[model samples]
Target: MNAFKSKTEFAQTSVFKLPHSFLNFDNFVSVMTRAHLDRAYWNTLLIIVAAVIGNVALGTMVAYVLGRFEFRLKKLIMGTYIALSFVPMITTQVATFTVVKNLHLYNTLWAAIVLNLGTSVLQLFIYLQFLRNIPRELDEAAMMEGASLFRIYRTIIFPLLTPATATIIIIKTINIYNDMFTPYLYMPAQKLTVVSTSLMNFSSERSTEWEMMSAAILMIMVPIIVLYLFFQKYVFAGIVNGAVK
Candidate 1:
């Protein structure tokens, strides 16, 4: 069959090309050095870490208040968050960019990090799901023992939210890692290239070298693949647990 022959030919070509392409570290090194990717890696790491912390802390607190407390404006607040989630991020890019420029954060790593610090509605919903599974009796008991709200969150609620937190971290890490648009738009300096934007170096207006491009893609993919493999169980666990309630 033609299909079978085509598949065979593709496999053979991949086997022949990929081995040589992947093994050639010169291209990888050249790309990294030329793009100043070492600095980029540090910048990306800082942004991811800082944004994850901010997202988790803020998201958890909001979910905790919305889930565990009874306030007059609760429904309105929840509705606002749900409504905002329906708005597409791309539609607001011009306004967002304007705000970033006005704030004097353009072309700075903090700009990316600050933009990502907002509470993720999905993460908040996940936290709310996990929060529902935790009985109110724990809070009551902790309160009876003179534990402040902060103490309860830190000592009890926070520990129980670990699985969900891990899931959020993994998801956000991948999102931030593959995000080329924000880094390219906000941090255009050649020295500020993240992994995603650095891949642009492989192609141009005239021609694209497929082998080098393939190599660069694999290099970009390796870290994410390794992270997923390592933390896959937590991701599944969070999904399963969150689905239960």
Candidate 2:
């Protein structure tokens, strides 16, 4: 409702009544025209796509190798992952920033993409959980038919992980979309703005344009809300299924 209010109306009071102009799109217009959200949208989309793909490929591969095969130090690796996950990410930002700087990824979209590209323990655990339910008989049967390990993974394993993949994609997309810290810290350029940082346009050292800011907030929120509303069932199902076994 604040999105439809004039500056004066918005400044006056918080009322339960209707907005000053229910049909007024001026705030939305101002946000679109003045803010860099159009460019931000594309930048965000690119990062989300790259990050999701990298995560899924690497995550599934790691889970497959660990879940299907017995290897030396396997327990050590899994333990390391669990231990590292307990460390707060904030504590490592200083070192991470230096590495990104050394790699010359500062102020580039690649910085965000590369930083978010890794598979978290959550994803690994989830994939491993699903993999447990898959029968080793499938692998043996495929091997008897002359199917290579890679072919079996690509055709049989990956295809069956669709529900888990969908869950990861949606979760990762939302996380990247809502994250302002990485983009703001790594890619501060105006052209590299993302939806998370686009709303900064309506703010200033002196005062904020609450009406326009409100409109921008609504716009930024709608996509994520719509996405979750549509795919929430998959998320719930994946989590519940993984947890069950």
Candidate 3:
């Protein structure tokens, strides 16, 4: 019951060393300095933007088609998508490399982006579900005004899909940012490494650099954590809006 007592009694562990440790600061300066974390930061950033925007845009378009338009074998298609959702990415890991190799995407950052965009099955479903709740009257009115399908999507539905869009972007931002396996598997070049992949390398190289690794981990995670902390309200709204309706 004594919150202050709990706070006062808390002790810093000896194992948890400070980031700017005097013991190791001078050693990593040489190797770390040459590598230049800034370059990696920019690279990671470029990959994230490419991955997130591509997935969201494509996913949204697919959702709109599935939601608004009805044709033959629609249920079968939806059912297949749902079934594919259950298949783990690991099941197709072998083929991904072959496909990437055929396109000569290996060791390149673009491979990271392309791989993620194609696998956004869950996102498409979320978009489709949200679009379903939109009134048919909206489309009818837009049609009466001579709005082409692309125009209606560009002008009408897209604006209204903002909540869903924002939600997917935030969530996918975290996913793509922290994703280590894909980049490691698809693009093994240390030069093409992202925050997650770099952290993995740092962790292994500096198995003893717990403090630096911790600092690096925090450095990579902080921005995303802060973003969610501040925008959790809207994030949840978007998720629920799409999930429920």
Candidate 4:
């Protein structure tokens, strides 16, 4: 068929031109050395680790308190969180940028990390759903064993929230990894480039080199792909358990 022949010709001309493109370490080295991607990788890793820890710890603690305890302003607080979720983040960019600027964190990595630490409503909701299934009797039992509130949370509630934690980590990892706009906007310095923004180096006003771009993309994808492969079971388990009961 003409279609088959065209496909074969295209593949031969394009992919086979640099048969070693995917396997070549030279492109990777070029990207890393030329762009100073080693520094960018470190910067990105630090941001992801800090952001995930803050998001998980803060989100989990808030969810635990909101789910387990009844307070006067519980409804109001929950309503506020839910309402804020409905407001698109893009709408608040101006205000957020202003705060970051005033804090003198505009070009710093902390700006990205701090802004992202705010608890995600979706993650909070998932935690609350999982919490509903965990009997309060466990807390009572632990308390009878001389466990304080913090002790109960640390030993009992926190351990039981593993699946939800894993889910949040996986989700947050992907989001933070692929997020180009925030890093681009907040980290304008060449040295502050993250993986997503670093890809821009392959493009220019005159022409874009598709071959190098593909190579760079594959390099960037390797870490996330490996991460998902390892944690996929936990992700599925978390989704199901969080949603079902």
Measured by lDDT, the strongest candidate is 2
Local accuracy of candidate 2 as per-residue lDDT tens digits, 100-201: 999999999999999998888888878998998889899999999999999999989999899999999998999999999999999999999999899999
Off by over 4 Å in 2: 15-17
Candidate 1, residues 108-175, lDDT tens digits: the string is 98888988888866777788889998999999999999999989998999889988999989988999
Top-TM-score candidate index: 2
Give Cα-based local distance difference scores for all models. 0.80, 0.91, 0.71, 0.83
TM-score result, candidate 1: 0.88
Q: Candidates' TM-scores?
A: 0.88, 0.96, 0.83, 0.88
After the best TM-score superposition of candidate 2, give how far the Cα of residue 84 lies from its true spot, in angstroms. 1.1
lDDT of 3 by residue, 1-245 (tens): 11111112223333433333334433244324534556667887898789888887788777888888889977887788878888898998898789899998988988888887853556766677678778889989999999999988888788888877888888888888778898888878767867776666445543434445544665566788998898788678776665653
List ranges where model 1 is wrong by over 4 Å. 1-22
CA error at residue 168 for candidate 2, angstroms: 0.5
RMSD vs true structure, all candidates: 4.9, 1.3, 6.0, 4.5
